[model samples]
Target: MRSFTTIFIALFCLGFVFGQTQGNDVLAMGRKVKKPKILSIEECKKIAQQEYNLHLGFHQKDTANYNLLKGAAITDWTIYLGIDDLPFAVEFLFAKHGLGVFTVVVCMRAERRYDILDGGSILMTEVLKRHPDAEAKLTISCLPQWFDTLRNKGYEVDERTPYRLYYFENLSSHFFVVFDLKKNGKREEVVIDLYNGFIQNIMPEWKTLEDLKRAQINFKPEPLPEMPKPKEKQEPKGKSSFPPEGKWEFSVTGVPGFLMSDLGKECAAVACTDVMIYWDNNGYLDDSDEQTYANDFCAYWGTNGRATYSQIYSGMPYVAEKHNDCYVPNGGGIRENASWAEAIQYFEALTQELGAQHPMVLNDYWPAPPHANCCIGLYGTGDDKSTWRYYRYDGINQLPQPLTVWRSSDQKWRPTAYVSGYCVGLPTVVWTSPLKGDENIDIGVQVQIHFSKKMNTSSVESQITITPEYARSYQWDPEQTTLMIIIQNPQQDLKFLTQYTIKIPATVEDITGKKLDGDKDGKWEGSPEDDYLFSFTTRGPKVSFTMVPSTHIESKTGCPPPNVQFTKFSRAILENKERRPFKVSFTAQESGEGSYELLVNELNLPEHATLCTLALKLTFTGNYHIDANANFSESIQGRDGIQITAPVDASVITQISCPNSPVPDNDWPDDNYSITNPSYPTPWFIDTESKVGILLNGFCAGMGHLLGRFKIPTVLVNTDLRILGTY
Candidate 1:
C-alpha cells in the first residue's frame, strides 16, 4: 500500500512538469488561479523567507561585484504587490526603501531578475490599504504593462483623472467609492478629479453617470437597511465634512515667520511652529509659547537637523484628526511620498499659498550638505518657473527675503535633486503696498490687494471698507489674484494730511470657498480677530524741510588686518604692532536734488591724523523736490570725490567731477530724484519713485563702503494725522 501511494505522488509531479513543458510558464497555466489572498505582514514575511535566504547566499559569492548597491546589507523577507494586487515580488532593503530598494520580481519563475523602485513610492505603504477582495488575474506582463492589464482583472483607471491626482482633495482616499449604495448591484470604481470635479460610473463600458443613464443600467436595489435611532436624545455628533465631494483646501492668513537660528537648525520644527503659532493664537491649541512648542517638537522627533520627512507626520502635523478644533480632517496633509517634480510642486504650493496654505518643511538633496528651510511665501505673476517667488524663512532677516534656491529638478538653471519633506498649515496675504505705518502716501494712492490665491471678487469687494470714506472704483487683475482700489480725492480734498485705513473683514473667501484666516493661526474663524486692518498716512498739501548743517567725526576701532592672523606666533607679533585707528570726518548741507560730491584728493595725510571740520552750505527746497532735514557726512569714504553722489537710479554711480567749480555756491545741480510726490501733481519727481534723502557723501577712513548707504529723507508729514472714518 505504501509503494502504491509513492507511485501516485510521482505521477502527480510528472503531470505538473508536463503542464509546464507545453510552453506555458505559469504554474497553473490552463487553469484559473483565484486572486491571491491578502495576508498580514507576518504571513508575507514567512512566505518569502526562503527567497530571502537564497539572495543572501548569492550576495556572499558575488566577488566580481558589478552591482553598486552601497549601503548596509539587507535580509528582511518582505512582499509588495503590483497594480494587479498580486504579490509577485520581494524587497531587499539595503539601508532603507528608495535609497537602495532592490526587488527580485517574478521570484516564482526562473526568469526573475532584480529591479529598483523609488524609496518614497506610495506603493511601499499602499499594500495593506487595498480592497482585500479585489477581482484579480495572474497575468504574465511586466510592470508598466500591468497598468493596462489591470482592466481585465475588474479594475479600471479613470483616464480623465490621473492617479497622481488622488491626493488633490482627499488625502486619505486611495480609490473612488460611491457613497450611495442603495441602487447598486456590483460597485464600479469611481475616481474624483480635483480640477474637473467627481465622476462616478455605474458600468465598465460607460465613461460617466450620463452614459449609465442613457444605457438604462440603473436597476434599483433594495435600500441599505438604516439603523433605527435610539429613543433617548443625545447631542448631534459633529458632521464630518470629509468625502463630501472633493479635497478640503484652504489658505490661512499670516503664515508666521521664524529663523532656524532661533531654534538651532531645526527648520522642520520651526516651520511647524509658524503654523502652530497661528493656530494657537486662533484658539486651536493650548500652548505656552512658540519657542517652547518648537523645542518640544524637535526633542520629540530627534530632528537634530535630519529626518525631516519622517518628522512631519510623526512629529507635528496640523489637521482635524490631530486637533479637533482645526477645520480640515485626517490630519489635513496629503499622503504623498514624492521626489523631484512632485516634491517641487508640493513646496511650490506651500510657497504660493495655493491649494493647501500650509507651512512646509522641504529638503535640498543636491547640495553637498543637503539642507531644508521653511517656505513662507511666493512672489511671481505668471506661469514662468523663473518668475515664481518662494523665500526661505529661516536665516532671513525680513519676511520678503529673496528665495533660497538650492536646486532645480531638471538639473538646469538650479541644482538637481530634492526631497519633499512635509506640508502643513496654509498661506494668505501676498503683500500690501504703502506697508503698515507707511507715510507720505498720495491721497489718491491706489491700494493693491494681492491674495495668496485666486479670490472670489464679490466676497472681497463686499468686505472692503475704507476709513474716512472716499469715492473708489475697483479693478481686478486678469487672474483675479490681485485687486486694485482706485481712490478719488474727497470733495474737500482734506483727505491729504489724513491717515487712511483699509479694513477687510475675515469674511472674504477664495474661489474654493475657504474664508480668509484673518489671524493666520492656520485656521479660519471669519471673526474680527482675523480681520486685515492696514493703515497709511497721506502726504500733506505742502511738503518742506531745511538742511541742519552739522559735522561728524569718529575713529575706527577693532579693524582686523587684511589676512588671517590667528596663529600663535602671528597673533603675538600682530598684537604688539597693531596700527592706530584712522580718523573719518565730514560735513554737508546741500549739493543737488539728485547729486552730491566729496573732496578726497588730499589723502597723502598719515592715518590717525586729526583734522579740523570743513565748511558746508544749508539750503531748502519745496519747488522741484523735498529736502532732507539732515547733514551728509564723508566720514565713511575717508578720501576722494566719492564724498557726494547722485541718488537717481538704483544701479548707476556717476561720481562728482574731479576739478571743483571755483564757486562752491553752484556746487550741485537741481534735479529731483524723489519718489512720487503726493499732494503736488508734478513736483519735478514722478509719483512712482522711492523716497530720496538729499544727502551728500563725505570723508571716512572706515573699511566698509558708503556706496549704497545715504540719508533717505522722510517728510515730516503731520505727526497728528488721524484716521477718522471706517466705512
Candidate 2:
C-alpha cells in the first residue's frame, strides 16, 4: 500500500471520475440515481470539527445539541449544531441525500465578534444551480465588518439595537443579518447580505440620540378628573307603602275635535279618532289628521255632536277601510248588558291580548246625560271597588288629563251604564258567485257579490261593471249585504264558449264609507284603474240525433219478425267551434236461413254494399244524406214452396239544422206501386242469382205498416226496412 495522503488522493480521484460518468448516464436516461443515506448527527459534527478546526466540545458531548432542520419535500435536510463557549453556530445542509454539501450557515449573536474563519467553505455548485443568487466561491464574511463600519459612521449599537442572523432556505448559500436601531419610540431596521459582503437596504431617519431626547422633553400629560365618593346603602320599600301593586295604567293619548267645542259631548267620535291614530302609529292604519278623522266619523255616524255606541260601532268599519286597516266589532250588544265585574274582566283580557293600551269609549247612563269619555287605565284601590281613570278631551285643550271615578255601592263602575260594544279593524271581500275561473257557466247566470259587512249599494252599483257589456239589473238583499246582478237579454246569449269578466272598481265603498280591500293587503289597490276581476266561460251549443222507425216487419210464414238496431254518435270537431261529428248505425237481426244485404249510394263510407247481414254504420261530416238499400231473403219450407215476399224499397232522408231550428224534410223519389196489379215498384227489383233485392212492402209502404215519418235537428237520422220470406 502507498502512503496515507497519496492513497486518499488516488481514491478521491477515482470516485470523482465514476460520479461524472454516472451523472452523464442519469441525464441521458432523463431519470435520477438512487440517493445515499443521510449523515448521522455525530458524523456531521465530526466533519464540522475536522473541516473548520472547531472545538465542538458541548455538541460532541450529547446528541441533543444537534437539531435537524427539515426542508420542503423536494429539498434536503439541514443539521444545526450548537457548541459550548462558541459565539457562532453552524448549519450543514446536504443536497440530493448525502451525496455532497449544499451550503453552510455560520450564525453569530449580537454581542459576539464575527470571523471569516468561523465556518469552512464548501462547493456550492448544486445550490447555485437551484438558486442563481447563491455564490459559488464566497471568500469574505461581512457580518463583523458591517458593525465596525456602523461604528465608524458614528452610530450607537447597544442592547436596544441588537442584531440577528437568519438562514432563509437550504437552496441558497446566502443569508441575512438584521440590525434594529431604536430612537425615541421608533425602530429603524437594516439588512445586510453576508454571501456577497454588501448591505441590502436600510430605513432612513434624520433624528439622532440628542434629537430624540429633546423631543421627549417637549411632551406633556393632561390631568384627569377625580371620581366621586360612594354613599351608604338603603333597604327596599314594602308593597304596602305605596298604592295597590297589581294596579295598571294605560297612557292613551287624547284627540281634540275639529268641529265640536267639547269632545266630551262627542266622546265616541273622539275616542275612535284617538284609537285610529294609535293604530296608524303601530303600522295598522295610514296616518291622517286627527281632526279630519273626527269630522269624517261624525258625518258617517249621522250625529251632529253626540253619537251612540251602535252608530260608532257601525261607522268604524268604514274608517278602517278608508285608512287601509282592519276592523273587528263585538256584534249584537255583547258589552251592552255586561255587568261591572264582567266589564273589568273583559277590559283586562282585551288589553293583555292586544299587548298595548287602547282608549275605550264609556257610556254613563246613570249620570242622566249618559256622557261619553275615553277610559285609559284601571287601578286596584285595595278594595272591592276599582278606580277607573279616563282621558277626557274638552275642545279647549289639545292633550287631556286623566280623571278618576270610584265604583258605586251597587258594584257598578263609573259610566254606571252597561258597557257598550267596541270595534277593531277587519276589512275583506267575503265571497263571489261563479267563483274565479269557473267554466261552463249558464248564459243567464246572475253574478252575486257578498261582502264581510253590509255595503253601500249605491256606491257598489256605480263601481260594478261587466266585460262585453250586457244589459243587467241590480238587486240587493234586505240587509244590503249581498248584491245580485241579473243579466237581462244579453247580446247573443252571452256568446257561446266565450269568457266573461265581472269587475268591481276600487271606489266601491261599504255602508261606513270604506272602499273595497280587494287584495286584502291593508291598502287600497287604487280606484277604477285597478279593479277586482273574475271571469267565467259560457257553455257551447249541443248537437244530437233523433231517429224514428221508418219501417217494421210483420211475422212471415209464422216466423217471428227480426229485430232491427239503430244508434247515433256525435263529437266536437274543433277547439271552441260548433263543428260536431255525426254518425248513425242500423243493424238488423238475422232469422232462420235468412240473409240481408245493405247498399249505400252517395254516402261518405268505405264501401257501397254489404252482404250476409243488414248492418250499416255511417258517419257524416256536414248536412248530407245517404241512400241505403236493404234486402232480406228468408227461406222457410212449408206447403207453399219457396214463398218469397216482394222486395221493400224505402228512402232515408237525414237533414242537419241549427241548435234553435227544427229539421227540414229532405226530398226523395216518390213511390210508384200498382196495388191492384200486385206488381213490383219501378226501380225496385229482385236479383235471382244472389236472391237479394226482395222488398218487404208489407212492412213499409203498404197499409198496416208499422212505420212513420220523423225529423231531427243538428243530428243524423236513419230509416230502412228488413224483409222476411219463406222458401
Candidate 3:
C-alpha cells in the first residue's frame, strides 16, 4: 500500500524529532509536538500565504544592509486585510477562518531613528469586526501572535497605550466577543482576559470613564449620512464706500519727533475731507539735556521747532511738512536760521488755511540730509550714548547727511558734522573763533537742546528742597558690610527644596514704605535714612546634576551609573545640549535618611532661553548629602503592608515596554528625554520576589527588542513570570 504509506509518514517524522529534544520544557515541549490542526477556511489561507512569503523574504533581504548612510529609511507596509462587499466566497470564508488562523509569521526593521513599529491591521480589524462567523477564525488566528511579537521587538516601539495594553483576562464563560480594537478610540484602560489567556493583567490604576460600554459592542461616533444640505445664498445689501468725512490722507517723514505723540493719538478727527496732520523735526530738536529737556518739553508739547502761528491755526487742519534743509555751520538748525526758500515760506504760512506739503514720502529707511563736513561714522544708537552718528556728505552723496545729534550731561553724544543718509539731532555746536577772550574761543551757539513728544509730568510734590547737611566724625561699620542679590531664570536640573518667589523692589523702600526689616541678627534694620533696602535673592539661579548611560543595556545586572551634582557655586559639568542626563543610581529605591530631589525638566525652551542649574553627585554607600532637587519624596519606605508613596525624583525613567522591547534607536532620548529615575511615587511595585524582576530596560542604540507587553505584577521563581522587558 504505497510501501505502507511510507511507513506511516516515517513514524510521524520520527515523532517530530523526538519532541524537539524535550528539555527546557514549555509545556513539556509543546506537548509532544503534533500541532497543525486549524481545521477549515482553506487551511487558514495556506498559512497566510506561507506567512506572507516569509515576510517578503525578510524585508527584501534586510533592506540593503540596514542604516545606509545615517537616518530615515523605512517605507514598506502593505497590509490590506479584507471585507467590504464580502462574497469572494464570503471573503474567502472570512479571510481564511478569520485572518489565516491566528496569524504568526512576522518581520521588522529599525535599530535607530526612534524605533517605532506599531501593531498590525489593528488586530486584524478587531478580529473581522468582532467575528462574522469568527472571520475565518479571527485573522487566520490572532495575526500570528500580533506580528510575531512586534517583529521580535527591535527599536521603534509603541504598540499603543501604556505601550499597547489590552488585557481581557476573564469574565465568566459565555464570551461572544465579536470585535473591538478601539472603537471610537481615546483609551487609557481596557482589560478583559477570559481565563484561557492565563489571567491577563492590565491594572496600572487610573480611572475616569464615561463610555466604551465594556466593549460588548454598541459603540457610537459613526454619523455621516443625510448628504443634501448646502444652500444658503443671500447678500444684496449696499451703500457704503466709506468716506463721509474720513480721507484727508497726508503722510510725511523726516523725523517728526518720532511722529508727533503717536500721530496725535492717531488723528482724532479734524472734519474736512477726513484728516491726517503729521510733522517732522528734521530741523533739529533731539533732547540732550537743555535745562532738563527745556523743562520737560516745556511741560508738555509746544516747542523744539515749527508750531507757533497761533499754534498752527488752532490745532487741526492738514499740514504735512517733512523737514531737511542741509546746513551745519556749527549745526543746531531751525533750518540753521531759515533758508530753504525761507523754510518753505515758513511752512506755507503755517499751513495757510490747511494744506501743506514738502518731500511727501520718499524715506527709504530714512534719507536726505548730508551737506557739511564729510566722513565720521559710528552707527547704532537708540539709547545709552544717544544714538545718531555719521558725519560726512557735503553735497555730492557719499551717504549720510541729516545731522544734529546730542543728549549730553554725562549721558554723552555730542558729535555735530552732518551730511549723509540723515536723521541726527543733538544741536548745540559752534567755534567761530577770533580768539576774543578765548576760553576755547566760541561764538553764539549753545541752543541745541530738545525734547517734546507731548510731555507731561511735573508736580513732583512742588519741586522740593529740604537741606540738612550735618556730618561729624561718624564710624558705624559692622565690619563694612557688602550687599549682593541677583538670581533670575536659572535652570538645568533645579528642584531641591522647591519654593520660589521674588519681587521685593519698591526700589528697596524703607522710610516708612517698609522693606528693610531683618533685625534680631540677620542685619538690615535700616538707618542711613533707610529708603527700603532688603532685596535678598542671590542664592538661586544655578543648578546642575548628571547621570546618563542606557543606550540599550538590558541585562548585565543593571548598568547605569555616572554620578553628577552641582548647586550653590558648583562650577559646571554640562550635557543637555538636547538633553541626556538619566542616571539616578538606585539606593534600594530610597526610604529614610531623607534626600532625593532630582527633578530636571527643561523640555521645549526658547522664549528667551534660560535653564542652567544642575549639580547632582550621589555616590555613597551611606552618608549622603546632595539632594539638590533630586528629591525622592523622602525616599520610598513601603515594606510589608506595601503602600509607600513619594518617590519621583525623575531624571528620565519611563519604563513600560515589552512585546519584545528594542524599538526606538537613534540612540534613545526623545519624548523630550530626561524624566524617569527612581520615579515610582505612586505604586510601581511589580518586583514580587525579585529574580531581578523590574528589569524593563530600553535605552536604545539599535538595542530594544521586545515590543508587545503590559502586564506588571511580577514574582519570578516563585512562579509569577509576566516579566516582558524594556521601556
Candidate 4:
C-alpha cells in the first residue's frame, strides 16, 4: 500500500512542471524536512477545526455554520472523517487548506505499529491467514477529470499509491499517507500527526529532476492490462443478427474470446456488438489433478503478485472475421483471485475503456436449479473491510446499484440486484414478430442472456430445460443438433462489478438436452450426460379484448383526495371481442372543491401465468356481454353520456350514468348535460320584439327528480358525473 502511494505522489508532482507554471511565496525555499512529533486525538481535532475556520475566512458565520465531517465505522474505537473539500469556509485554527482527505481505519487498541507492510497488525494477520497466497497491497490511482470533481468535493479515496507503507512505531502499526500538490515544480509534504490521524505541519521539498523521477517510479501502478495489438479484427458472420427494419429481436451465444473479438462497425453487414461476460470462480472448478493444493480462494485471498493476463482471442470464425476486439483475459478480463485493491484498480481501467455498447452475460449459472442465488465480494481485512459488490452494467437502465451490506435474504435475486444498482442477468427469450407462413412453420428460436456479477448457484449450469407450454401438442423439433446457444457480453463489463472476486468458471455446459421434465426437475444437476442443460424463458401468445357497459359514473358527498366519487356505476362488457379478460377495480375520492373524475383506458394485464394458454383462460374470451350496475344512495342520480359531465350547481341528489356498449368507460357525459336554450330566435319562435326566456334553465336543478328518470339515447360507451352537494 505504501509503495503505491509513493508512486501516486511522484506522478502528481510531474503535472506542474510539464504544463503550467505558477509562483507562490509559501512554496519558495522548499526543502525536505524531518518528520514531526505525534499529537493526541484532541490536538488533532483542534488543528482540524482551526484550519477549517481559517479556510472559511470572512464567509464564516455563527457556530451554526460550522463544518461537519462525514464518519465511517472502520473499527471498534476509531471513527474516521473527511474535511478537505471546504475551500469557501475558513478554518480559523489550522495552517493551510488541502485538496484531499483521508479515511483512516483504526481499531479499539490504543497502540500499534507505525509502519510495517506484511498486512497491518495481529488482527490483520489472523484475517490474512485465510487467504493463502494473497498479500495486502494498496492502489494509488487518480480519478479523471469528472471524477476529480467529486474527489475535489471531499470524497475520500482508498489505497491507490505506491509511496504508502505499513509502519510500526511506539505502539500501533498504521498505514499512513499525505497528499500535497506544489506549484513551483517542487513537492509539498504535509505532516499528518499519526498519533490520531490528523494533519500537523507542512514543508516544501525542492527535488532534483532525478529525485522526481525516482518518486514517480515509486508511485503506485495503474490497474491495467498489457496493451494488445491495436486495430484488431472481427470474426466473419458475427454472432448477433441485425434485422433490416421494424421491431426485430435477436440473441447471440458463444461470442469469440476478447483477444480476437472484433466489435464490427455500424455499417458492417454482420455487426458484432460489444457485450459483457461475468467472470467467476469457486473452488469447485479446481480438480485435484490440476493443482496439488487448493483451498476456496473465493472465500478469502489478498495479494499483488498474482496479477497476470490471459490472451483470450476470438475463437469462433463468425466472431473472428466480422468483429474486432482482441481481449487479454488477465489484464482486461475480470480479476477475482487478486486482492480487493487490485480488483478495484483492474475494473476502473477496464470500464473506462469499454464505455457503453457493452453487454453482460453470466456464462456459468451456479448453485443448482429450482433454487435462486446471487454472489457478492467483500474487501479489506478485519473490521475495516466493506462490501459494495453487485452484478450490473456500468450504465444500464432501470438497474439497481449494489449495497455494502445485505438488505434482505429473499429467495429471489431480483430484489437485491434490482435495488442495489446491480444489473439483471437473467436469461430471456427475445420475441420477434411472427413470420408469415403456415402456422406449423418455425421462424426461429433463441435465448436472451443477461450478465450478473453474482450467480445464485452453479445449479443453472447443472441442467437446463427449454419447453413450450401451450405448444406442447405440436410435433416439436428435436433437440441438441437442431439448436445451440452462444454467450457474448464483455470482459471489462464484469471486472468492475466484483470486489475480491475469483477466476471465472472455464466451461459452461447445459445438463439438459432441451427436454422438459414433467416433474419440473429438468434443471441440471451433477449428473451423467443423459440430460442436457438448456436455459430459456417461457413465452406465450398475444391477445386483445373489450369490456361491455364500459362506462361507470358516480356522484357523492364526503370525497377525499381524488375528490370525485361515483354513487352509482354501470359497465357493459362487449360481446364477441377477441381480447383476453383482465379484472380491474376502482374507487374514487370525494372531498372539498378539489373533486375530479377518473377514467381508465387500456389497462394492461399482468404477466401472471407460466403458460400463454393459461393466460388466455384467465382472461374473458369468446362472444359474451355482461352489465355491472350498482346504486349507493338516493342523493346520487345516474345519467348516460359520451363523456363525464360536470355538475352546474350543488344539489343534495345527483345522478351519474354509463353507456351499455362494450366500448371503454371514459367517453360518457354528453347525454346528461345536453339541454339547449329553447328561447332562441328560431323561425317559429320569432321573439325579437319581446323579452324572451329559456325553458330548461329555470327548472334544470330539479328536473331530473321531478321527471322520475331522464330517458336519453345510449351510446356504446359513456359516463356522467354529478355532485351531491356544493363544496
What RMSD does each model have against the real structure? 26.1, 38.4, 47.7, 26.3
> Candidates' TM-scores?
0.28, 0.31, 0.15, 0.21
Candidate 1 lDDT by residue in tens digits, 43-90: 434433433333333334333221322232333333332222233343
Clashes (N, CA, C under 3 Å) per candidate: 33, 13, 130, 169
Off by over 4 Å in 4: 1-213, 217-283, 289-727
* Per-residue alpha-carbon lDDT of candidate 4 for residues 1-727, written as tens digits (9 for 90 to 100): 1234333443443333223223321121243222222334444344334322222331123232122222211111121111110011111111112211112222112222111111111111222243333221111122122234324534443334222221221111122234443424555542222321211111213123233223333433223243333222222243222111222111122221221112111101101111212211111111222111111110112211011121111211112111121122211323223454443343343232222223232111111011111111211112221222222211110111121221112211111110001111221121211221213211123332222112222333333332221111111123211122221221101111111111112223222212222122423232333222332221222222222123232212111224222232222121111122222322332322222223332232332211000000001112222222211111111123232222112111222223223443453343223222323231222111223221222132223223323332111211232111111
Candidate scoring better on lDDT of 2 and 4: 2
Task: Tell me the lDDT of model 1 at 45.
Answer: 41
What TM-score does candidate 1 get on C-alpha atoms? 0.28
The alpha-carbon deviation from the true structure for residue 287 of candidate 3, after best TM-score superposition, in angstroms, is 20
Question: Model 2, 1-727: lDDT tens per residue?
Answer: 2234323322443343345544223221234544222333344444433322221221232233111112201122222211111112344433233322223333333222121112222222222343444331211233445665665555556323434443322111224445565435556665454532333223222123222223223322121112112111112234222233344333333222221343322556766676566566555556776776777787887774466655655566677667654454431111334665455444444333222444444443433234444444333333333233433432222223223343232333333221222233333566888899999887667888777666788888887778766667899898677788876554323444568888887778776666777776766667643467889887654322122222221112221223432222211111111222212233334323223333221221111111121133322222223333222211122223553322112223332211112222432222212123312232222122332232322222222121111211111112333322111
Span of 10 residues, lowest total lDDT, candidate 3: 81-90
Against the true structure, candidate 2 reaches a TM-score of 0.31
When 1 and 2 are scored with lDDT, the better candidate is 2
Highest lDDT scorer: 2
Residue-wise C-alpha lDDT for candidate 3, range 1-727, written one tens digit per residue: 1123223322433343344344432232113322221223344344334433322332232343121111221211111110110001101111221132222211111111111111121112222333333211211122223323332432222222121112111111111111223333432333222111211222212121112123212222122122121111212236321111311112122211111221121111111001111122222322232233222222233443222222222222112111211111111111222333433232222222122222111101111111112222222222222222222222111122222232222222222211111122211111111211223211111211111111111211122111111111112112111111111212222222232222222123211222232222223444443222221111221222222221223223232222432111111112222121222232214332224433443232222222222222223222233322222222222324453333333333211111123344553333222323422223322333434342222221011111102333332121133332211
Ten contiguous residues minimizing lDDT sum, candidate 4? 610-619
